[model samples]
Target: MLQKKLMLLGGLRYLLPVIEEAHNLGVYVITADYLPNNFAHRYSDEYCNVSIIDKDAVLAKARELKIDGILAHAVDPGVVSAAYVAEKMGLPFQCSYEAACILQDKSLFREFLTEHGFNTPKAKGYENIEDALNDVDYFNWPVIVKPVDSAGSKGVTKVEDKSKLREAIETAISSSYSRHFIIEDFLDKVGAQSSADIFTVDGKLVYATYSDQLFDPDAANPYTPAIEIWPSSMEQKFQDDLTAQLQRLFDLLHVKSGIYNVESRVCSNGKAYIMEVSPRGGGNRIAELQDMATGQNLIQNEIKKALGMPLDNITAPEYKGVWCNYILHSNKQGTLASLEFDQEFQSKYIRDVGLIVKNGDQIVPFTGANSSLGTLFLRFDTREELDSTLNRISDYIHINLR
Candidate 1:
């Protein structure tokens, strides 16, 4: 039998598990991106140096390679390109190229939600600063300004004062590849927002889970999720409503089978809003953490779906215990000194520690997902212990720097 070939669009460390899964299934893996030294490239069977965001370039390479399947997985920028290539080559994908474009671009997504009568924040997308500045009155006060096509909360600013709107727009445009930005009314959340990966099969919502998306107020970017706790504290009624809404959305978009990183919140206005739903696995190892908490391997199932292989029966993940994925990051830019952990806390709570940097390596403030140091997988016997420990997380874990 001929070996199946799979071309992955990005070489970030998040794709490592995807490559591992494909290899376990006896599939040949090709990692492609502009950077050759990316961590995942070291593990892939082949390396192809092509810019992933450029759909035409990726399509050319995929055609030349005659790959059997392709996927972007946790990489946000490459999702549209992957869909485009899959559509052009008549391969399997989560959605059409047009659907991917709408889902990936914040502006387009907001428009879609509003047009479809989803409970979305009032938002507008702009390609120029002058246009955004002129329409400040369109949004309610305390609006959020962000890049229309960027992910991991890069260049997101909360503008309480109208005077700071221009600076916020500049920051957003700087982070955007298309030089576009979005200004949306901030939905004051009732509690910690929910962000997790959910799966659909043939446009039917099959499996869903939500996490408490926690953030560090002191971090350089407070919008970037610092910790994620499984089995969200959100009320069951709200979760069910969100699930139904998501299924409706999938049906409307004709979404195919795959995993989607969904962000939702129950607002102070007594309504639930789906903030973002991108057709790819979320960064920060969200799917991996889900696997640990629920005993479901979404990573492997996603790989199977990508290759057009039969998928394992995916269902709602049942949490075995309270779990948290602590994102390791520094609040300041400096040289790494050492990581300090309280011995008793480490022995009891810490399940696994994955560090990307070593002592003496240079470190930066946590501005976005790209600046994260690593992740600490933790498990607690009860919700009370998890809440208490996380509230005083600094007492147990410290990232010392020079």
Candidate 2:
């Protein structure tokens, strides 16, 4: 019984539920990048002419497609070449390649979470902006300068003083591909770090999910995290203290099988600051709204944890429901002429409605999360009918720009 040959790298729009849960568990998906109309390459089955930071042309096309599984769930420039083809085909990845180069080098993941203190958020790593203006008095007024590597929040900024901190560290070190730049110390905190997104196989945590933060009050200055909502509102003793600090950080970075995706934050005085850790998964449409709110396929459990199997025999579907995603930002730089959502104001909690760019497709002003143009995938069954179907679909959508 061996028909699992998966290899997915980059494709915007959260790799469409890892290519529809690895083609509904039969697993033989393939999706390399260089954007050929990327929306998970229209539900991948195969397509690789590579280029997502081509790590040896994606390990020579995953060893000329022997591919028994090696993934890069939702883009981070293809998670270090899908952990270097699961470290040259040994497989079962989620760390190693030196913890995927300390989680894709956000200044070595904030110095490995500030040397294990873990509640980190007073950061500062820079390949010069005069070492962030000599630690800019250790940090104070509205600070955050991101791009120690880059992600959806491409370049991320927010600097309340010193005349905008040298153009926000030269636009976060010129959009760092690794030129480095990170400047934190601005956890004014409301909530934007509920990406637990776990799933380990040999190392056990068997599937888990939680992602929240879908805000946009005019894209809230230097704050980032514009949209994403899932099974979290952030309080269950702060997700059991972020599941005991991410199970002691994947047991001190061993990370057993595939998919890790941790990001953390919770400080209205509760204090829980992980801030980043991405093996992969959760970009937009968060694993397709976590498999439409917990059916738990996660791309055939990341192809049965890259074929080692044993995720306690996969049944998962208790179904409470409350998935949400909404991002329509444009503050100027426009084109898209229409995008209206209401659908009789509530087609039983609408499951999807994407407006993925068209009508000229220019719009790019809302900075972070790569200026998401449209999305809204609510599902309901509780959280007060998903907040009354997101306030009656925000009084029926009307997102026109021009």
lDDT by residue for model 2 over 129-149, one digit each (tens)? 776786778886778888777
Clash total of candidate 2: 1
Residue ranges of candidate 2 with Cα displaced over 4 Å:
1-92, 97-99, 107-129, 132-144, 147-155, 158-163, 166-217, 222-257, 260-277, 283-285, 288-290, 293-296, 299-324, 327-343, 352-394, 397-402
Residue pairs with clashing backbones, model 1: none
Best by lDDT: 1
In model 1, where do residues sit more than 4 Å from their true spots? none
The TM-score that candidate 2 achieves is 0.31
Of candidate 1, the 10-residue stretch with the lowest lDDT total is 298-307
Worst 10 residues of 2 by lDDT: 311-320
